[model samples]
Target: MTDALNAPGGLSRRRLLTAAGALGAVGLAAALSGCAADDPLAQQARAGDNKNYVAGDGSVTEYAKDTRKPPVDFTGVLYDGTKLGSKDLVGHVTVLNFWFAACAPCRVEAPELEALHTEFKPQGIVFYGVNLRDEQGTAEAFEQSFKLTYPSFNDKDGQVLLAMSGMVPPGAVPTTLVLDKQGRVASRVLGQLERGTLKTLITSAAAE
Candidate 1:
């Protein structure tokens, strides 16, 4: 993003970490190289192996209707101290974003998520964040700075992450999942978000 885009003091202003690199940049990718240390893609990035892994490339992937598996159901506490679960997400499409307060790419995608939330929320799609790290205060600060209205789960104990287990795995620190109305995992973006791709996915999911 340009300096103008990162400028502060507006309703849409972003008080992002200046030192953190932009999404899809080599520096930003390097920072998350081990964000999920055991994740194969992260390992490849760290080793400079350049294998099948396109680490932090901001790719958006949607599962074919037949390919989508059963819904992911889990429960945890939100930053506001409220309880949330898969049952709570049913009947409406939902977007689950995995992030932490200090992750640069997470900051990069915050506004986009907020925009999607603003657009699709009126259509009844719920947006929630799963924070793999950081305290409540930190997460709330990031929420305020990003002007995000969606509630985020506090996964500090890994309850939410553990529930997602093999699927999405929290391997990529900044991953997003779009759940269909039935609560099934319909689409996933494994790294930094692509705004246009996400909008299309959300739009399609909302229509389903």
Candidate 2:
């Protein structure tokens, strides 16, 4: 999980292919296309055999169905001290990711969360970060350091965590909740997401 995805001057797949095509001229234009067509989450799936994300006592579980709906109104405060409420994200699929900067698994899954944010933003998907047990500076810096575009709500008092304890464990960090347009919990990935699973779940939830 410690690959240098932030490599200096490291060519993104697109950039590398673009440079290749520029040198190749028109001979391989179509060949260079569809580079990211395959699932980006493929790597995580391959690394699945590396770790067991199962929780003790089977307390954490994934939501296997899409029938659950969110409340009509919800509200919270973001890390930047901005107010965010349910009405702001109404009629869109919203993903709430709960994490802390100190958690190693949370760091491992951060990139995938950013990727999902970029991939599904234009598709009517909304992402909200819930920084649990985190300081305002650390949470803000984490978002900035990762280039994460989604706004995060600080759970310094764990108010949101207490509210969601019935559906999610209060001890669970890096928990992801998928909510339908109406603000209902559609699906939840209790632990780290296997790369593309987050994006896929968001897309499916949006379509639902």
Candidate 3:
């Protein structure tokens, strides 16, 4: 989980290969576990596992069907100081990315994330970032530098993180999650995103 994903040169060939392998591993595990949406909320049985993410390994995990957890509820102050809560996203497939101004991988994926925000905007796929560090000006500067339009919450005190409680705790600096229409945790990418995989994940969630 601690592997460096996007370096100064951007996603390396090794990272690409690792992502492919990770996807394969996730698929295999899902298949073996018969994990589907029939009772997605069954995740309650795995509460012990939700303690924290182990590390960043560029892996993607999708909890579709019976394996998806219930919609998470939270409220926080956005970077622009707007009041935001999970209820507002009930009907849409939303993307939540955890990041900060100083993370190299965060900067590397900013443009790509903005692209996803734009591409999915019309489809009702909203993207929001959760700043794990940095104050307003610092986070805003990063957003401006990347020309990102979506609003990010400045969770400097980690209140937003605490709100997550036992479910899908963002364990790494650049974790990305796709919340389904019901606001449930649908899928998560544990490191710097692969645009195609994320797009596919979000698209699938939107369609569902």
Candidate 4:
């Protein structure tokens, strides 16, 4: 897989992290290394690639909830007090990112996430964030510091967080979920992702 990503016109997700390391970054190594096949993050990525965000039996593994819809609807709040819900995002390809302001890993990956959001948003991919285990003011401050342009939901009590199958267990910060236009959980990327990998996901989901 590393070889494949390093091939011509290919972007090895790990290699990208290597370059990111020279810049004195944090958590990029764990984020990228864990993304390899056989790793927990990689398993989720493959499941998503196979359109198995919902398990083989059509059930969410960690969470007991089952969905009749391809993509389940979610509702919460933006950092600025605006409402965010599945209905608000109808007819769009949405990349939902679960994060927390206090998580160092999440903070480290914010720039790259923001970059993907900026690059693909104009192409019809919308980035919706779920800020978990933090106050609205803290989440809002993080957004301001990062100059984040995408809208994010505040999961202060973790009710919304607990409800998300892919996001439950809270194993890691900065989990990503790609929802197709028809509202299916097309891809689930656990932990942070490289810009190239994220772009490819957005492109594929938008095409669907």
Model 4 stretches with alpha carbons more than 4 Å out: 1-69, 166-168
| Candidate 3 TM-score, C-alpha based | 0.72
Per-model TM values vs. the true structure? 0.72, 0.67, 0.72, 0.65
- lDDT per residue (tens digit) for residues 1-208 in model 4: 1132343444453454345434323333443432132344334443454221222211111111133235566678777778767776668888888877655445545666777777786787788888777677787777887678887887876766766764334645557766767666655566545555555556656765
**Per-residue lDDT of candidate 1, residues 1-208 (tens digit):** 1121332342231222221223324333432322243344434444545344233555455565666778787889998889988988889989999988666557656766786688787788889999988898999987887678999999989988887776565547688888898888877777777565576667768887
Which stretches in model 3 have alpha-carbon errors above 4 Å? 1-55, 165-171
Residue-wise lDDT of candidate 2 within 1-208, one digit each (tens)?
Answer: 0111222443452354344334433322222223212323323322453232333121122343333434635567888789877778768888888877655456556666776678788787888888877788888776775567888888778777776756667666568877777777766676655444455456656766
**What ranges in model 2 sit over 4 Å off?**
1-73
User: Which residue pairs overlap in candidate 4's backbone?
Assistant: 71-183
The per-prediction CA RMSD against the true structure, in angstroms, equals: 12.3, 13.0, 14.1, 11.0
Query: Which candidate, 1 or 4, has the higher lDDT?
Result: 1
